[model samples]
Target chain A: MSDGPAIETRGVTRVFESRKGFLFREKTRTEALKGVDLVVERGAIFGLLGPNGAGKTTFTKILSTLLLPTSGTALVLGHSVTKETAWLRPRMGLVLGGERGLYNRVSGRENLRYFADLYGVPIAERERRIGEVLERVGLTDAADRRTEEYSRGMKQKLHIARGILHRPEILFLDEPTIGLDPKSARETRKLIRSLVSDGVTIFLTTHYMFEAEELCPRIAILSRGRIVARDTLDGLRTLVGGDRTFEVEAYGFEDREIESLRHLPGVSKVASEEYGPATRLTMRVRTRETTLDDVRGLLPGHPELAVRERRTSLEDVYLDLVEEEAT
Target chain B: MAASAPAYTRARSTVASLRLAVLQFMADPQWLIPSMIAPVIFGLVSFELFRGYGPYFLIYAILGAGMMSMWGQTLYGSGWATGQDRNFGTLEPTIQSPTPYLYVVLGRVLWNVVSGLFGGLIVYAVVVGAAGQPPALANPLASIALFVFVMLTLAAIGVVFAAFYVYTRYAGFIQNIGEFAFYVGTGCMFPVVLLPFAVTPIALVFPPTWALDALRYVAIPGYTGFGWGLWGDVAGAVASTAVYLAIAGLIFRRVERQVLAKGNLSDY
Candidate 1:
């Protein structure tokens, strides 16, 4: 691999077209990606988070050379996905981990062995590498069993085992931990982190906010086929609102009272939700300029009031940014 | 950091996937029963129909039924494997690998030739049992070589049609629709002479038409297909097979690009 960002895209766009109707067969086009520009440094765990149709998988597919971009450009390890795939494919690994990607009748080891040869893993070390990957994924015991009998999590682990079997320089993992139990997901995250420490750049996409926050040092949020935000959690925290959120609950609060809370010093935004008889005002505060006492004081008329302060979670940040884009 | 491995070689991928195909077949070998049902019936029916054609009738039955079975496995085997990859969602990763997809495909084709031989045996057993005797060949060794050659020709055609599967996930449907057309066009059940004069040119396009004709000329004493004799039939089969092999190599590159461009490699 040449020297450059592990992954980079310049306004990359992908449009998918399909024909419908029996007689007319009108063509309908769906733009899966819209001019996405991003960069991922080498050896870092970069995460992509998105809604179901937000095109996270499409971006991963383009970078991994599985699909061609309709316009713009995507490069992996300084090689264009479109023209330099021959140079890029061997150095890149993709784990689209799901129930579908494995041969049901073959053993898990056989699946990895097949990919090892396809990726040109050295013949002398092929078996050892397959064994090691199976062990790393905690699948050594199940390696010889036919994959058809393996559970979804085991099949997912097999997907990961095949992905890292060749020791690629950059790995594209599209929701690698999806569908696994918490313990398996944690182990998979640990494996991903270990891969990063071993100098493999990881481009991860996941719906699990905590997973991304725990594993990815930097992340990009894709909303509506465009990247709404890309930065460290703190950076995104600032972009969405702040690193601190204050939750205030009461029987009720007036619109003017809510507006006053939104205008308070250090308050970036205020959102309200009703749960049965009570209302909760979620205030994103950037600094200590606003406190729980201040929120409580603004709604002093309510006898039943509960106020607390907590650090903004990644989920809060994600919803803030994605909701903003939705509006 | 782990040391990255080198690029894949065509030979190793071929062997590895060929082994995979056999392992998978062994794992769920029952599919073999369904695949043979049609050919076995065709063989038994051909035996009854050809029983009155004299001593040469047995050779006719064997050639007809054996070629039919080989035609199914050798031609549909690789395409079926590709379609299976699409369903299993394994096609995405396999296509993503550095090894050109054709090598992986060639592995399946080669394995199919082996399994296709098993198919031929099934048909042969059915026909021979129905005849209550083995077919007498004018030149048994020559006929054997020609039978294997016919299989290779079918394999060549198979390799090319396999490209169709790699090109689209719906290839199985398309191939299914064209299957009987192919059987008739390739003259798998009989000689190309039986096809219409206008369709003869289309029949000659497939390597099996020439090859099966060549095998019959060797196995039957008075068989004179196309009046070209055995050597001409052999030469025609060789040229057509070579052409098909060359097309297989070229078609894959184009199909790979087409599928990638359409973003439909995973559409199944």
Candidate 2:
């Protein structure tokens, strides 16, 4: 083990060049990572949250040595990603989601054994480790069946089993439970928690806010190739500065009614969208100056407005941070 | 720590890769059926067409079909396998493994060569059964040794072809071109002596041409020289095999670096 942060990046950037049109007519450059710096301490579940095209996958690729940064430096387990990939690759694991990573034609046990060999697990311990991982992922009964015949959730579990087969120190998981059923997703979360309890550091990325809040003590939100915010759940909630949010469900409110609500005293932000049969309106107000009773007092005499106070959640903080960066 | 950990891991990885190649080949009917049937069909057809020239012609056809089988399998088993890995999305995972990528590829090529040799033996059986006699050899040991060497030479060339296939999206086009080009250039169906005068030099550069010529010299019993003497042909095959292996190593390393730099390992 090296005496430093488990993972660190300094001003890392990646630019992808693509050409389009006939006979190479045009060249376009997309900067996927724009001079970002991040650090993950040892033995922590660090969550990275982002929307589509936010460079989360590109960052994972750079850290795993699958792609080299266009500029700057990234170190994993104290070794340079570009110059020391051979030394660094063995100590870390990477799990990318979707159904394409495993060998569909072979049995799960065979796939595990092949990866064990690739990771150079000792011959004496290969079978025991394979069995243990299979049991841990709840794939023991299905381990002998061909992977193609397994359900998507089962295959994802097998992917997780393959990632931790060598007992790597740092694991990079990108959307591990994206399409799983509720039960399977919960089980997968349990597996991740157990992995953390065993002292393995996890770098996770997901769109599930509750999953992040439950698993990660610290989280970072990325938008448009930059880290917009990094802090704990409670810390991120403080970013809104003691603003209370109220939700109103109504059927007859139009753009005029929304404009009226925006002009009310103590209200800072008003946003609305269609939800089911009613239009859902949300307004953020300074909690020290406004109360739920005061909000109802300003509503139009249209008898359909049903109002209630909403709790602050990580999703609210995430949306606030991402929406701020977009502007 | 075990003193033999490095060697043990390399051997284990090689075996694992070999197992994967064999399983994939067996599981896919598109490759298995054609690979098993073509050489035998070609061997029988050639024997029936050339029965007037004596047993030597039968030997020629068998050996020709044998080399062709090896070449075809190299393209399909090694080169096309890499393309399939990309489509299956397993290419990145394999690259991410702790084992060196070169060894995994070499193991796959080795399986193709071995499987090709097995296919060649079947072709030989068909030739002998159809002709009612086995071809005599002037130096049996030399013929056997040369046969093993040629398979290895073809494996090295296959690795080079696979490197190109791994990096490019035109893998199918390359496989088509490589299969037909080697069949003609290596004189798989006929002697290079009958090819046009200008084409012989181009044919001479490929190791398979020298390999086939060397095999013919020892196996045909009363055979006479064409371009070089027996020892010269043998030496040429050895030298070309070395050169091809070196080129394969360099190309493999270059493509590995380029793909990592470009971040296109999973691109289909």
Worst 10 residues of 2 chain A by lDDT: A235-244
Give per-model TM-scores.
0.97, 0.92
Q: Give the alpha carbon lDDT tens digit for every residue of B113-211 in model 2.
A: 888887787788888898788867667788878777778777767777788776776777877866777778777667677788787888888887787
Instruction: Please list the residue runs of candidate 2 whose C-alpha ends up more than 4 Å from where it truly belongs after superposition.
Output: A20-28, A241-244, A249-268, A272-280, A285-289, A300-302, B1-8, B29-31, B222-227
DockQ values per model: 0.73, 0.47
Per-residue lDDT of candidate 1, residues A1-327 (tens digit): 456888889999999997768964899999999999999999889999998999999899999999999999888887799999888788888999988999889889888988898888989999999989999989999999999999888888888888888888889999998889988888888889988888899999998999999999999999999999999999999987899999988888899999989888989999999978999889899988777778877887988889988999889999998999999
Clashing pairs in 2: none
The single-chain TM-score for chain B of candidate 2 is 0.89
Off by over 4 Å in 1: B1-5, B34-40
Best by DockQ: 1
